[model samples]
Target: MVDDLALARHLADLADAITASRFRSRDLAVDRKPDRTPVTDADLAVEDAVRAALAEHRPGDEIAGEERGGQVGAGRTWVLDPIDGTKNFLRGVPAWATLLALVEDGSPVVGMISAPALGRRWEAASGRGAQAGPPGSPEPISVSGVGELADAYVSTTHLGTWVEHHSRESYLRLVDACWENRAFGDFWQHCLVAEGAIDLAAEPIVNPWDVAAVQVIVQEAGGTFTDLSGERTFQGGSALSSNTRLHDGALALLRR
Candidate 1:
């Protein structure tokens, strides 16, 4: 098992160097057609760097990334999202991150989420707990203690999509019940849950790369992760993550 957290940190470092350097560079211009070249370049570069490092260190492991598809090696596969919030990156918003996770068979055991622009990184391995903060400045964080649904805070990313999918009424009902709400899209909201800064995150639509790393971080931080229907797997295309106390309540609201 490539269980070393240091290696995870190193991989995150490789991703950060590539992303931070080009984050808001005027030369890295954005076009109206959603020129994906810049973020695509960053993605491939970061993934390639990670693959190279893994080749040298964890030679027997497989690797998968958003930019280049999947490469099956050993039973263990490293899942990566070179930039989870590509739209945010294109918009000069610092909400993007590099997400890495080690999945054995079909489950993620270790996850690392690095957002250099936000000056934060979160890392977790099965049974090791989750850690987050600026590089080299780690803090032990966990989910919030608010067990009641009415006192909870909620974050919903991609509001328009929820309404488009006819889940708007239920979502609005959820908002009315929450103490506060944030449309802060992308991985940051999930990290907020991991840091005990937020109660629940209702993500109506996302891909594996979007939630893989966050899944491990939240679970390791003592929170629950599941589809809106409450299944543990991420295959349902949406997820509801929160402290265990309010998960069912949040799930009930989302399902309605």
Candidate 2:
């Protein structure tokens, strides 16, 4: 068997190189997907680079990417989101990241998120512990110990999506109960939860590519990652990641 985690990290490195080069390039091209979300040349380039590397290294593995779709085979499947925060990246914000994951039989076994603009990267395998920082001096990371919602710091990508998806009331109630809340948005919010910088991070709707990498990272970092309904799967269409201590409470509030 291959060292899946190592391969994931290597893929992240490959993606980071492409994304960093085009971060704010004035000539960068932009397009819109059918869902109305933005897609940039950087996104397409990053995915293409990773896909090419994977083909050379693990040709048998299936591949699925946000910009360019591929099959999810019965065996190992690699998922890629070239840029998780394209809006932020286009706006010159430093919160975007390239997310990658290896899924085996429907569950993620290895994951990685690389944010070169922010100078950070995080990765995890099913059994190995989660880690963050530069490749040279990585550090093990874990979730916060916040046990109560009233004492917790929370984050979400956007409230408008929640409202549009019929989750606004539940989301607001949870935020009202928290000590503080921010629109940290995208992959950064969940990475923060894994790093113990925040207690919880939720999203009303998300594609598998958006949460697959972060799911394993959060779980390996001693946190609980679930959909708003409390099921622990990235395909749930939404996410609610928190320190294990606060997960149930947050889930209950969001489901009520």
Candidate 3:
């Protein structure tokens, strides 16, 4: 089981090499899918590299990547979002990351998030606590002690997403209830919740790849992850990460 975590780390390292090199390249290639989201050359390259490494290291494991589009079914599936913040990557925002999660029986047991540009990598296994920083030296992390929404800090990807997918009014109720808030979009906000930098990270729209690894890290770090409907599954179509003490309250506000 631990070996699977090691393989995920190795895969993150492989992705780092490709993403770091191409992050700000003058000649980086960008394309658009039917959804109008940007896909950079680095995104495709990192997924391809990680897929190859997994083929050699864990031949029997299945892979589902943002670029390649495979399914996570009733077995061990390696989920990959080669670049969790592709728009950030393309625009050189420094908040993008390579997200990998090992899902078994529909739940992620091992999660690894590598944001090389920020020089931090956060990871967690099902029974192990979460950790962050470089692989050379890691430190265990957990959620904040804030128990009340009025004293908490919160975040989300974008206000526009709430309007488009769920309800911006509902998301605003969450923010207005908090002490402070930021847009801190993508994987970083959830990681912040895990490491206690913030108290809540909510998103009205997300794919499983967007939050699968996030679910594990936050949960292992003494937090909670669920959709607006309050279901604890990553495939719930939306997500909210919070210090466990504040999860229910946060959910109540978001559903307002």
What is every candidate's alpha-carbon RMSD to the true fold? 2.6, 1.2, 1.1
User: After superposing candidate 3, which stretches have Cα over 4 Å from the reference?
Assistant: none
Candidate with best lDDT: 3
Estimate, for each residue in 1-256, the C-alpha lDDT of model 3 and write its tens digit.
4498888888998999999999999999999989999999999999999999888888898999999999999989999999999998999889999999999989999999999999999999999999999865779999999988999999887778899988878887888898999989899999999999999999888998999999999999999999989999999999999999999998888884
Error of 2 at 167 (Å): 2.1
Full-model lDDT for every candidate: 0.83, 0.91, 0.92
Assess every candidate by TM-score.
Answer: 0.91, 0.97, 0.98
Candidate 3, run of 10 with poorest lDDT? 1-10
Q: What is the per-residue lDDT of model 1 for residues 142-218, given as tens digits with 9 covering 90 to 100? A: 99999888899899976787977539888988888899998877788888999999999888887777787788899
* Comparing 2 and 3 on TM-score, the stronger one: 3
lDDT measured at residue 217 in model 3 versus the true structure, 0 to 100 = 96
How would you order the candidates by lDDT, starting with the best? 3, 2, 1
Query: Tens digit of lDDT per residue, candidate 2, span 1-256?
Result: 4588878878888888888889988998999988899999999999999999999999989999998997555789999999999999998898899999998888888989999999999999999999999864679999999899999999986778888874778988899999999989999999999999999999999999999998999999999998888899988899989999999888888985
User: Candidate 2, clashing residue pairs?
Assistant: none
Better of 1 and 3 by TM-score: 3
